[model samples]
Structures are given as structure tokens and as C-alpha cells.
Target: MAYVLVLNSGSSSVKFQLVDPAGEATDAPLVSGLVEQVGEPMGAVSVTVGGQEHREELEIPTHSFGLERAFAIMGEHNVGPTDVEVIAVGHRVVHGGKLFSEPQLIVDEIESMIEDLIPLAPLHNPANLDGIRVARAMLPDIPHVAVFDTAFFNHIPPAAALYAINSEVASQYDVRRYGFHGTSHEFVSQQVPKLLDKDPATVNQITLHLGNGASAAAIRHGRPIDTSMGLTPLAGLAMGTRCGDIDPGIIFHLVRQAGMSIDEIDNLLNKQSGVKGIAGVNDFRLLRQRIEEQDQDAWLAYNIYIHQLRRFIGSYMIALGRVDAITFTAGVGENDTEVRQDALYNLDMYGIHFDKEANLVRSKEPRMISTADSPVKVFVVPTNEELAIAQKSAAVAAQARAEGLY
Candidate 1:
């Protein structure tokens, strides 16, 4: 079967999936794998195909070698990278900056533009570039497309996009709200209207993408007006490893009184300040267990997460004015019953009525967890970013072919 190889490359890991471009949004990948600890002496590889998982630990010297080895493992399962025809390649680029708002056919100039925006996403864009370069080199015959995480929020109004800082510096550094996890947000928001049995064009929704990395988007009539994430992914709701919204003075205090360097402060806020920093663990399941065990720190972390989430929900409700649905998506949002329940609770005055039993019933399919009498609907819609990438990549490649760009 022809498939699109979707790659989401991180600094220390590379995740890949072989997706059928024509498949349903809820369809699973034909093959999937993750290569972790790239360039490390001891690395691990995990591949899943046809319901079985194969894992091993080795010295994965480079991204290229790791991916080739993963493909070899897939070959044993009869769906190697080269075993079947690869129609196109889809890459997840974290930051598109101001240049790209839609999926782009990966040409040399496109790659250059992506590279140019690396500073905006220093931790992500370079690794994304690495995946694009390596995949293009490995399969030079097929078209490669880049689907950016920030592309969906590119059209946000300037008021919501810009910060109150010096305009010159902000423009010089391309600093403004870009909103990450946009592929997931866009895909999930599109699915909401279907569940509501309404036209996509008229739906006003608030989609909370809660996971290890979470963000909220206020989508009005199918376009994002404001999102929780700002110029960086670190600016939104408190995430697993990120502090989310914190006072700028805290950074100053850390620098002046705590004697922390800029890099040290960056590391503190980005890696050590979220739910993990407070509870000593990042996984929601573990955090929930701790909360049930009456761990004060874990309880505080959970309250912080919910408080921040509710703040966004309230603000978004005001921003959208007429809200249709509020969707809980991604990892924690889709599966966690209490998190979903607590997020929209006690809002009877504001047209939100949470159904306790419905929220507790877990399923992969999109399900509404709101009462019938409520004006605003609440849903738990599972997100499928890989399939979104495949469909987007296929469309971009098809467009390029029609325009004779390839």
C-alpha cells in the first residue's frame, strides 16, 4: 500500500509513522516507531506493527542509522520504508514563523526558510530540519511536505498575537503568539462540528489540547482568534514540564537574587517548573494517584493545572461570545475523567452543565460529556496528528504536481 511517512523529530528522539493518506481520520498507522537517545552511547528503539511491539537497546550513533535500523525492523513485518511505494513524506515542523501558514512542498527554499526560523523554536526547528533533510536524502524520488505546528494560528488578530513589549524588538526577533500543537488543534476542532451535526463554518468552539504539552485555542467560526500559547509553547497553560504562564518578575528574581544565568532560568522554566516540578512526576496518571493518596504537592499541582485551564476557558468563552462546544483532546484531556469533569464544573450560570457519568465513560471515539439541556456542549475528541499530517502532506504533494513545482 502507498503511504506517507510522517516524521516528528525531536532533539533526542525521532518518531515515525507510515500512514495511508486516503484513510479515515481515526485510522491507525500501518507502521510506527520511535528512536530515542540519538547520538547517545546507549539508545533505544521501539517499533509497533500489526499489534506487536519490538524493542531493543543499542548504540544508535545517528538519526540516519536509527531510522534505517527501524525500517529494517519494519521490513521483517512486511512494511519496510522501501518495501511499498511511498507516495510522499510528511514532516512536523514546530515553528513556521511568519513565512508559512499552510503545508509547503519541501523545496530547498522552503527548507531554508524553516532553518531561518530556528531561533524562534531553538529546541524544535533544528531537529525538524534534520528529519526533513535526512528523509529527503533517503527518499529523493518522492515529494516531501512540511506541516507546521504554528501554521493554524498564523491568522490570529495582531492584538491577540502580539505582546506589549517593544514593537521593534518583537518584530526583530519575530516574537509573538504562534500557538503550537496547531495540527492537533486544527484536526480536533474540525471534528467537533461533525459531532454537533453542524456546518464547520458556523461553529464557535474552544479546544483544549491537554497532554504532556497542553494549549487552549479559542476558535470562532472555524478560525482561531486567540490561543493559550503565546510566542513560545512555554507561554500557555501549565504543562507537564513547562511552567506555562508565570510572572516575568520571577525570571528577574531568579537572575538577581537566585544568581541564575539566562540559560539556567530558561532550563528552569522550560524543563523543571510544571506539574513535574511541583509533584516530582510529569505523568498525569502518576499525579492523579498522588492526589488520591493525599499528597499535598500533587494536589497543589493538580489545582494549578485546573485553575490555569479554567482561566483560559473563561477568557475564551468571552472572546468567542457565542460558544458552541468545548472539546477536551490530546492525552490528559481525552482519557482523564476528573480533569475533564473539573475543568467545566460549576458553570451553570454560563451555560455549561457537566455530566458526571458521561465524562467517566472512556472511549477512543469522540463522545459528548455535557448534558442535553446545556447551551454549551463538552466533548472528548481523540486527536490524530499523524493522520492529519498524512492528509495534509498528500494534498500539498498533489498541488505541487499540478503546479509542476516538483
Candidate 2:
């Protein structure tokens, strides 16, 4: 009954889960919860244990405070640090740069290496590091692992990774595509082969991780050959508040003609753009509702999102040459039926016969939404990044323990 605690720490929130890596009896988590609005005047923590949910509002002025409070709540269920034997703590680090291509045990030097990558993921890495540091301090007996979001895409071909810039300049500046949401993409890639009963080394898949932030990956033979996200998470499919795939000249024009500061331009594109910029809302459900009400802006945003997503799917299909399965995951991909419908509409030419009725059914389990006769399979696979992290973390910890390092 080796337990692994997985933590995904964002700039303002932390999602935690406890799981058994073996998962022989049940795949469900032993415990899970979230701490929201850290460093704000009003913050809250929510925890679920044994199929029961609990919540509390308190002062979470820092990641440390929020995590400590969460532990306290878990204590009520007898699953806290003092009661449970946690084998490993896994932190979802957003960027690993070119230095790491897999999960690494978090040591002093490893922490420093992660810190060096802060520039690559300014918004996510720091917060991830914060959680790692706090967790290490709280539970010094167990090994902590840093699972990277960019690790899965590190194997992408050089032709796909390198920018079309000067070789020396690109190398000096470390400019290359480093995809995000890799944990989800890798998990989906592995699952697709099992779902189809195909050999992992012979499978090809196009995975869509659509949420507030969205990205796509083309997996060939269980490895990523290409992905949508670039050096940052902002380069992928249109996201909740991000202007994805915009012309670089737009930045120059904003600075020269519009007199917008660099920071202002960044904020505008990353925070105020996308569906939010177009329709004044980033929520997919709300946008769909407004579209039902015949709001033109909402309709426009929806069209733009679907168009961009379809373009990527088509390109990835070409990149893979042939596809076995096209899997969708994440918040929007799993729950938003219209999004899946619109993106795959009229793709029969590509041998994709989307089952509209099948797509309309909402379920948490992985299921197909394409006709059995279709050349390519379409599936709604819920992304369980925490489970993936837990497995990886447990493996790394077990290895370390066997090597007499833990």
C-alpha cells in the first residue's frame, strides 16, 4: 500500500491528491482536495475523503499556509502526514528545458536546476518550486520528485523543435519549442494504445488537451513527434484568455504604432485576449449559452476556436501520415460536447466519421465517439495527470530507496 502524494501548484492555487500507485483494487484516489486564492484576503480549502467532501474558509496568505491548512483538514480524516506513510511527493513542474527529459528526484541541485528554468516558465515554475520546497520541509523522510510538463515533448524531432532562426542565436538564447500539458498528453498517448488493443510501439495518436489552456500533440509510436505549444503555453490553440498563434508582427505594431509597453502587450495577449477578448468571457459553457442566445461575439469566438483546433488536427494527421486514434482530454475536451463536435465536423474525407449522438453523451469514463467502421477512432479520455504523476513519483522513489539514496 505505497502511497504517493501529487501536488499541482499554480500561481494562485494548489491541487493535491493521494493515491496508491499499484491501483490493483481501485483507481480512485484515497484523498484529494484543493486550496484556492492563496495570498489573497479570502482563501479556502476543500478536501474529499472516503467519498465525503469538506471545505473551510481561512487565511491562506502563502502557499505554505494553504498547504499547512490542507494538511490539517486531511488530518481530520486520519490521512495527514503524521498518520499516513507517504512514500513519495510528486510536484508538477511546468518546464524542464533541455536539461531534463524525465522525472527527477528533487534534491538541492535539482531544485537549483529547476530554478534556472524559471525564465522558461515564468508564471508556473516558481509556484511549482514553492510547493516542492514546502513539501520537502514538511516531510523530510520521503523522497520528492519533480515531474515536468515539458518532459514528454522533449523527444520531438529537431526539425519540429528548432525555430527557423539563426542557429547560433537560437542556441545561445535557448529558443526552441517546449510543449506544455505533457503529462496529460503522455497519459493519453499511453492509454490510447490500450483502448485500441494495439502495440504501444506501433500506435499513432493525436491528443487534444483543451481546458482554460489548450494544446495538441501528435504521438507516433508512443512518442511525441510534434506538439502545438511552443516555448510557452501561449503558443498553442486559442486558450481561455490567450491569443494563440498570433503573428509576431502584432507585438511590433503594438509597440511602434500603438505605443503599448512590453508588459502591457504581454498582459493584453495572455490575459485579455482569446475568447475573453472577443466575447468578454473565457468560460466555454457561458460562451455556448450566449451563442444559444444569438450573441454574435460569442459565435465569432466559438468559430475561431474551432477553426484553430481543426487546423492543428489536420496538420497533425498529415504529420503522423496515419492515425489510429484521436483522443480528447482536459476540462473542455472531456465535458464540452459542442467543442468536440465542431472540431471534428465534416472530417469524413479524412475517414473520420464522428458519431454526433455518441459525442453528446456525457460520462467520466473513456469512451468512443466515432463509428466503429470509421478509419480513425475518436475517444473522450479524461486526463488524470495526478495519477500519472503519482505513478512516476512512486517509481522514482522506489528506485531511489532501492539504491540506498532515500
Candidate 3:
């Protein structure tokens, strides 16, 4: 069977999945695995195949080594390099800048373009590139495709994408809103129309992807019109360890008064802030426990999170003009019922009537959480970014084959 391997490579970890994109027999992956703590003394690789999980501890000093070990593990499951045919490898590239608006077949020139976009995604693009290079070297004959996180927001009009700064400076620097989580947003937005049994062209929805890293997007007529995250993922909702939206003056004050270096300030805002900054923890479950114990700090963090989420929802509601549905996806969005309720509370004026009972039901499948009489439907959709990447990659590879390029 032909498969598409999807890789989401991070600084110290890599998550991968093998999917038969056209498989209709089941909705499960052929194989999935993760390599964690690369470059560390103790590293681990775990794989799930045929409904069973297997793990190993090894020295994975780099992404290349980790990926090689992953391939070896897959071999044990009879999906080795010589056994199964891999048609394409799909990479989750964090930034595409203005160069790419859709999945593109990776070539040497395209690789160089991704390298040039390093400044726009300092922490993510390099790792993504590394994975691409390694995978290409390992599977030299197979086609590779890059599915960008910023591609879904490429169509957002200038009125929403451009910053109200000096036009000359902004243009020179290529500064504008380039939303992240495009795969999740696009996947969830398409699912909304199917859930409502409506034409995608007639659907206007807001999708909230709230995981450790969170963002919101306003999709009008099946296209993204605006999103909460800006040029970087750090600009949107308060994340696990990010400060989210903050005044520009705070950086200057910290530099002049607090005598903090630029790197130090960046570390503080990106690593030490958010719920972790306020409550001394980043995990939602731990924060909820602290809240149950009447910890004021955790409560405050929870309040701030819900407040920001509600603000974005309200703004997107205005942007859409007439909202049909609002979807919640990703980890926090799909599982956190309290957050869902609090975010949609007191929105009766917007025709959003929350059904508390329906919200509390825990399920992985997509379902409506709004009351029957509510004009605006609320849904919880579990995002499958890997599947989306595989589907796109398969399509690109097939198109290339039709042109005799692959």
C-alpha cells in the first residue's frame, strides 16, 4: 500500500504519522510515533502500529539520528524502507512567508526559500527544514511536500492582514499578519459545513484552536478573512508559556528600567509568562486543581484566559457580520468544557445560547454543544492536522505524477 509520511518536527522532538491518504477501510493511521528529547542524554522513541504501542530508549543526538531510529522501528512493524511504498513525505512547515499559499512540492530552490524565511519563524522553520533535508536524503526517489501553517491566512484581505504602521518600513520588513495553525483552522472550517449540512460557500464560522499554543480564525464563505494570531504565534491568545498580546512600551520599560537584555526579555515573554507566569504552572489540569484549592493565582490565570478568548470571539463575530457556527478544536478547545462555557457565556445578544448540559459531555467526535434554539451553532471538533497534511501531500504528489514530474 502506498503511504504518506507526515512529520511535525520541533526543536527537540519530532512527531510522525504514516497514512494511506486514500484509505477508506479505517480512519486510523498505519503507524504513528514520536521521538523526544533529542540531543539529551536520555532520549526515547515510541511507536504505535496495528493498535499496539512499542517504545525504546536510545541516544538520539539530532533530528537525523532520531528519524533514522524511527525508520528502523517502523521496519520492525513490517513497514520498513523495503516493505511499504511511500509515495510522499509531507512536512509541517511553520512559516511560508508570502512565497507559498498552498502545499508545494519541495525542490532545492524551495528549500532555499524556506531557509530565507528563517527570520519570520526563528524557532520552528529550521527544525522543519532539518526534517525535510533528512527525509529527502533517506527517501531520495520519493516526492516531498511542504504544508505551511501560514498558508490558510494568505487570502485574508489587506485590511485585516496589514498593520497600521509606517507603510514604507512595514513593506521593507514584510511585516504583516501571517496566522499560524492553518492546518487545524482549515480542517475544522471545512468540517463545520458538513456538520450543519450546508454549502461551504454559504458558511461563515469562527474556529478556535486552543492548545498550548492557541489562535482564532474568522472564516467567511470557506475562506479565512482574519485571524487572531499575527505575524507570529506569540501575538494571539494567552498560551501555555507565552504572554500573548502586550503593549510595546513594556519591552522598552524592561530594557531601560529593569536592565533586561533583549534575549532575557524574549525568554521571559515566550518561556516564563502566560499561565505559567501567573500561576507557576502551564498544565491546565494542574491549574484547575489549584483553582479547586482556592488558589487566587490560578483563578486569575483562568479568568484572563477566558477573557481574552471571549474578546476574540466577539471581534470575529463582528468581522463575519452573520455567524453560522463557532468551532473549538485542538487540546484545550476540544476537552476544556469550562473554558467553552465561559467563553460563550452572556452572548445571548449575539444569538449564542449555550447549552450547559451538552457542553459537559466528553467525546472526541465532532458534535454540537449549542442549544437547538440558538441561532449560532457551537461545535467541538477534534483536529487531525496530520491527516490534513497527508491529504494535501497526496494530492500534490498525484498532480506532479500526472505532469510526469514525479
Candidate 4:
């Protein structure tokens, strides 16, 4: 089978999956693994193949060492890149800026362009670049493709994309709402039309990608009308540890009154806020347990999370005018029935009728959870970003081959 190696590299960890090119979106990867704690004193690596798992704890000093050991483990299972027909390596690049609206075959110039975008994604792009460089060196013979997370919503209308700040200043710094989690939103939104059996260009969707890191997108037809995320992932919904939407004046207040540095404030809002900031726990399961135990803080966190979610949902409903479907994907949206129920609670006036029993049913496959006769449908579609990236990478690689670019 022809497989695409999909890699999502963060600052300290790498998530890798070997995806069959012809696999369904919901299909499990042929092999999956994680190389964690890179450059740390004690690191761990694990690979799962054919429902079997093996893990090792050692110093994963660099991206190269970590990945090499991961592939080595897969080799022991006789499913390594060398043993299989690996066609391309797909990379999850966080910020493509405005330059990339689609996946591109990785070339030196492409890598350089990605590097140039590092300033826009200081925390994510560097690690992504490191992984790309290391993977390219390790698998020099195969095609490498950069699948951007922001590419899907790159064309959001000017009103939605621009910040109301000085246009000159915004232009100078490239400040605009370049939505994150585009891969998930795009993948899920496409499935909405298919499920409704409506034409892709005629469907309107509000996709809520609720996970540790959550974001919402309002897609009119196939194009994004607006999205919750802005220039950075920190601007969207209150996530596991993100502050989400907040007044800009608060930054000035913190600097002037609290004497906090920019980096400290950045860490605070991005790592110390959100559900974690209020409930002292970011995991939805833990927060739910606390709520069951009558913890007031947990209740507040849940309320804030749901409140912000409902606000966005309502706004998108208005933006679309005639809504077709409301989709909930990612972790929290898929598994947490309470969140799903509460997010759409009392929206019957908006032509949405949530099915209580249907919402309770849990499965990995994409399924609808709204009344059959409701004008607006609600669904819990699983977002398969790895599969999307792998498929895009395969297509881009094939295109490159046809054009003799490789």
C-alpha cells in the first residue's frame, strides 16, 4: 500500500502517523507513534502497529534522534518506511501567512518561505521547520509536502480578516485573522454537505472544533465567511489554557499596573488561562467531575466555556442568515454530550432542534444528532486532520510528479 507519513511537530513532541493513501477519513492509521520530550533529559518514544504497542524511555536529544528511533521501532514490526511503499511526508505547518492557500510540495524555497513566516508563529513554526529539515534529510528520496493549518480559511472576507486597528499598522505587521485549525474545520465542513446530500457550493455551515484547543468557522458554501481564531490560535474560544477573546486594553493594564513583561503576559494568557485559569483543570473529564462534585469554580469555567461557544454559534447563525448545519468536531465536541447539548440549548428559534437521545450516542464515525425535520441540522463529525494532510500531500506530490517538479 502507498502510505503518506504525516507528522505534527510541536516544540517538545512529535506525533507521527503512517496513513494509507486510500484509507477512509475515519480509518485508523497503519502505524502511529509519538516522540516526546525532545532535547529534554528524560524522553519517551512509542510506536503502535497492528494494535500492538512498544515504548522506550531514553534521551531524545534532537528531532533527528527521536524520529530515527521511532522509525527504527516501526522497522522491528516490519512496517517501516524502508519496508513499505512510502510516497510522501506530510508536515503540519501552523502558519502559512497569506502566501500559501493550499498545500505545496516542500522545496528549499518553500522551506525558506516557511521560515520567513516564523515571526507570525514564533512558538510553532520553528519546531515545524526543525521537523521538516530533519525528516527531509532522513527521507531524501521521497516527496515532502507542507500542509498548512491556516490555508483553508486564508480567503475569509476582508471585514472578517482585518482587525479594526490602524490599517497601516495592521498592514505593517501583517496583523489579520489568519484562522488556525483550518485543517479540522475544512475537513469537517466538507462532510456536512455530503451528509445533508446538498451541493457543496450551496451549503452553509458553522463548524465548532472543540478540543483542548478550540476554534469555530462560519463557512458560506465552501468559502469561510468568518472564523473564531485570529492572527494566532490564542484569539479564539477559551481553550484548555488559552484566554481566547479579550479586550486589548487588558494588555496595557497588565504592563502598566501589574508590571508584567510581554513574555510573562503571553505565557499567562496562552498557558495559564481558559478553563485551566478558572477551574484549575483543563481536561473536560476532570472539570465535569468537579462539576458533579458541586465545585463552583468548575461550574464557572463550564459556564464561561459554553457561554462563549453559544455567542459564537449565535453570531454565525446570523451571519449565514439561512443556516444549513451546525457541526461539532474534535475532542470536546465529539465526546462531551453535555457540552454539545448546552451549546445548542434553546436554539429552537433558530430552526435547530437538538435530539437528546441522539446526542447521547457515541461513536467514531460522523453522524447527525439533530431532529430529522429540523431546518438546521446538528452533527458530530470526527475531524481527521492526519488523513486530510496525508491525502493533500499525496495529491500535491502526484501533481509535482506530473509537472516534473520532483
The Cα local distance difference test for each model comes to 0.92, 0.92, 0.92, 0.95
Write candidate 1's Cα lDDT for 1-406 as tens digits.
Answer: 7799999998888999999989887788898899999999899989999878999899998888888889889888889877887888999999999898999999999999999998898889999999889888888888999999999999999999999999999988888888989999999999999999999999999999999999999999899999998888999899999999999999999899989999999999999989999999999999989998999999999999999999999999999999999999999998889898888879989999988988889689889999988899999999999999999999988888798876
Tens-place lDDT digits, model 4, residues 1-406: 7999999998989999999878898788999999999989999999999888899999999989999999999999999999998989999999999999999999999999999999999999999999999999999999999999999989999999999899999998999999999999998998999999999999999999999999999999888999999999999788999999999899999999999999999999999999999999999999999999999999999999999999999999889888999999999999999999999999898899999999999899999999999999999999999999999999998998899876
How far is 276's C-alpha from truth in model 4 (Å)? 0.2
lDDT of 3 by residue, 229-277 (tens): 8988889799899989999899999999999999999899999999999
In model 4, which range of ten residues has the least summed lDDT? 397-406
Candidate 1, pairs of clashing residues: none
TM-score of each: 0.98, 0.97, 0.98, 0.99
* Candidate with maximal TM-score: 4
User: Any idea how many clashes model 4 has?
Assistant: 0
Clashing residue pairs, backbone N/CA/C < 3 A, model 2: none
Determine which window of 10 residues in candidate 2 has minimal summed lDDT.
19-28
Instruction: Write down the TM-score for model 4.
Output: 0.99
lDDT of 2 by residue, 13-82 (tens): 9999998877731378989999999988899999999889889998789888888888998998899867
Task: Provide the global lDDT of candidate 2 against the true structure.
Answer: 0.92
How would the candidate models be sorted by TM-score, starting from the highest? 4, 1, 3, 2
What is the total number of backbone clashes in candidate 1? 0
RMSD to the native, candidate 1? Answer: 1.1
